[model samples]
Target: MHRTDNRHAPGASHNPRASQTHSGGSDTGHQSPGHQGAGHQARSVEAHRESVRELLADLAGTGRTEQLPLREALGRGLAADITAPVDLPPFANSQMDGFAVRSTDIPDGGTDLRVVAPIPAGAVAAPLQPGTAAPIMTGAMIPPGADAVVPIEKAVPDSFPRPGSTASVRLPATENGMYVRTAGSDVRAGEPALAGGTNLGPGQLGLLAALGITQVTVHRNLKVLLATTGDEVVEPGSPLEPGKIYDANGTLLEAAMRQAGLEVLRAAISTDNPEELTAMLRKHAPAVDLIVTTGGVSKGAYEVVRQAAGGQDIEFLHVAMQPGGPQGIGKFDGVPFVGFPGNPVSCLVSFEMFLRPVLSALFGAPAPRPAIRARLAEPVESPAGKHQVRRGTVLPDGTVRLEGGPGSHLVHALANSNALIHLPAGTSALAAGAEVEVWTL
Candidate 1:
């Protein structure tokens, strides 16, 4: 399904892994996005996401495997290993419309024989008597005691060898196994057909159907606590103050979570209240798989989220990417908490570049498609020290053009963009027509 045509233009920077040194101060440290404390630099998006992925892999530690019927298997990650039920084509059948006869009889004058009862499909006839011929249909089981089939056109029609009719008949010469489909020919009964951990798509489902299975057990879906935090944001329909805006991050994040197939338990919007946020999390952390909060993890003074999650194992870190530099990851209570930047654009960008990919791997599905190379619509530049994921669109010739500025506050621009063009760290401006790589949403 397509989302509404809302997106943002991209901003820029270099990959974080470029150069470890930044000429910031005499007493030097890593040049992190000055998010939490000035001296504590943030990790690059790549570095941070790798750590997060490792955490997720640990969380997804090998689950119990199981078996399931094919009908209920759509989109499910295979739990139990599956083996083929039986050898395909359980019996040998004729491959041509012809007469069943001993090959020796066909070369002699007495090759003709009387036709007995009709051998249509589904009826089991007694074994063919020697020297007598039976008519066989395509896919019809070859009667036992018969040596081979002579095509219909090769012999006389109606009954058997007549008194006046010549007993001699020309036989069609062919190998013994010709026109025969042997039992267990296509597959072996005990062979593994589907392995564990494969996501069951239509083709996989069909295999189960062919095996006559009707049910399949899948792993439980990831349960998530979805929420947005900020005092400046108001719910829809409330009067807009000079500095207040409607809460887009909550709605947007929830929808994206659903798109990624995580079951979201909507946590209420929390103003910059540390105690309230902490208490709420304390109550629900035990039941959720992940606690996702947007906003307030930044270095700003009113970092309510940072305060509420205080004293826990959580550490708020800035990543190298612009607009989304502010991020927080720590264990809230017992469950893992992922703090996204307050800006609407930043939250979604962090998701696309980081969280979503981890979720996809855990669920045994393909990661979101990455952006492709394209020509530039115009010229642009970045602080050549971070991997910049910029919002852009494909032109008529498949080229990607910049969408907007690098400011984290530009929700509209990010909303209007369909893709992010990534530029490596330590490199600067690109003139029109320069090549770039992109990751499409």
Candidate 2:
């Protein structure tokens, strides 16, 4: 049964009260022509963002965790705090390959000490005889009674003598504990090594391995059913029919979702037929935690997603944002559904603006993209009543230049850009050198 929670449904009405916090005027400058609707009012970006957050809120409380091997745990969020079971380094070890000797044995002017048996890494060395030194390799356990290590380069001979040969090497004066990695110095036993909600990365996994931890407990990844629609969409590598374009949205969205640490189950391409699309969603809905479909939420004559999801609690609406103005969010057959526009760039921007942030806040897996302020390298005009997200390249001098014009189909421009230039809804135009907010891609 399809259900709609009032809290998660933002399409209750076409409220045209755009937030005045952002600069505004009539939607004239950079709005997509295909997305402009004369009668329907658009919602603010913040309202739709909040709706998305509300829809996905329950994911964080699922409390579902899984035990995975260290290798498999990469990109997963830690379910619980991981405390160090043993002191890092485990014991006092040599930080240099040289002689381990009592600091008192070396005089202020320097002195020569008889070398005892050599100690290599992984070997337990006998305590150093009072006035003698021990040749120790890096990482070798420091001999008992020895309080300092002199690097081999500091030795007069500058090298270790043959094992068992009586050799006395001149050593310089040194302080206690010099060149020694003391137990617990890196991390003490019982100290928190990793906190809950930490996204496991290469460094985190390496640390766990160094601590002799072979497995970790982490939050299970959210599984999503991804579908892309459009009758003109065809698979790549196949011969392109005259009026058909390759299905870039499917690949683009799948990559974005995966990079965000989502487990995507991409469905076969759905045609423009409403019934076929609905059937596909119904088939995959049971297995995934969320369903995301691209290319059919607009109010066009043949909007399949709108037609199919009309009675299933999905609310199709326009957001006061350029490029990705159209959006649909609600439940389909008891599963969360998000409908994104079909244009490649619009689809991607929608994901970044709406889905990515919510996922980060809820799952703690893909950390949020960094938002920064950069100077504009050139003047740019934006729609009077809509937030404009333009592709831009940040210059070495910290200024950003537009990669392409404000078009939803500008995929190539998006590829060459490093940031998303954000001009708030009320903003109409800005001169070069104006400081603007940007999101690093």
Candidate 3:
């Protein structure tokens, strides 16, 4: 029997789940100064999943592909249905190197057939005449009147020789439909080969290629505009003043967005200013499908993104989630805008929990994995009314152990963890070996 362990080992080992998190989401939603933690309803996992599903529904469906190059089609969603033009296989073909024979010709001493034409794959073939054998290579078309194929290893070469080669087999047991692929065996004409919302992975692409499709209609890649803002933040390579730290969220999130197959980090600016952030968004929002901004979304007076969208439909919902609770979501200049807390870890977690789920539904990729039930290998404390997504590892023996301290803003810990074990709202603590749910990173 196989078991998964979630316990912390003495040293680092490969996590059993081998999972990647959704985009930037702090597993934790934080509290600003002078604010109180509101009592939060701990919704069931299914309820949270439904919330993500609804958000995707709110967005207008992505644009239809006018046309797309097959080379760039990986991970893109198909915009329209694709049907096969002709029957797959197109004709009867042998599945093995064998001799084609009438079903009645089988059984020792049943019928001694004379040799006729030979057929190889990629060569046109004629139907076999009664009592005559056609030498057939693997994938060679079976001639008419032949109902079965006898493996070459079982047939006598003297019985039916290759057209231009000495290779032959001894005639043996003949089985019906043995090593034969009939016309349209895999797919029929007029049947849907691919459909809208299908993401083109290797398997799907192969299926399309099998149907002879050189072009595909796929949804336009989601275009997103992003900005990082903070007076105390400096871009890398620039000298930093007192109390100012270099911006990491911008580059981190740009890489993350690129990883998710979105168009990001293309704009000219990577600096911080309320006016600049607002202008960048206002200018790009119309052209892009979504806008994301980090840093200035916090409650501080200098919160550029929040102030810019002050009168907009944006709502800063301090979701009960930890490390990523400070979030704003709504429309801006007719485009959907998402705001993430400034902290690097928070932004990462926000992307994982909220943005990625919605994106998965829209773009049709596999959704970020959800919390799986596991047993804790040690005891831990939690803040009441908050759902903490703490970094952890799941062992093959089924124990889950914390990877680092519970601080949600630690980027290194976030990177090392393979999962976020859920500490449900209002739960103060848990002892070792308690069953818990963990969200795979």
Best by lDDT: 2
Local accuracy of candidate 3 as per-residue lDDT tens digits, 1-441: 011121111111111111122122233323321132233222322334345455445553544344777777887767777888878878889987767887666565444566666887988888777666677888888887887877766666544463665442446656678788999998888887777767788888888887788888766667788777665667789896766677777788888787777887445433445567677777777788778887555444455666788678776545555666556667887677777777777677678777776676666653346758899999988766566667888889989988887655566777777887878765678999999888876
Residue 440 alpha-carbon offset, candidate 2, angstroms: 4.4
lDDT of each: 0.65, 0.81, 0.66
lDDT of 1 at 303: 70
- Relative to the unseen true structure, what is the C-alpha lDDT of residue 404 in candidate 3, on a scale of 0 to 100? 80
Q: Name the runs in model 3 displaced over 4 angstroms.
A: 1-64, 108-114, 156-169, 265-276, 298-302, 365-387, 392-402, 417-441
Clashes of 2: 2
The lDDT of model 2 is 0.81
Give RMSD to native, each candidate: 9.4, 6.4, 8.3
Q: After superposition, how far is residue 138 of candidate 2 from its true place, in Å?
A: 1.3
Q: lDDT: which is higher, 2 or 3?
A: 2
For residue 1, give model 2's deviation from the true position in Å: 39
Model 2 lDDT tens row, 28-82:
2354322344444567787788899999887776467789999898888887889
lDDT of 1: 0.65
Sorting all predicted structures by TM-score, with the top scorer first, yields: 2, 3, 1
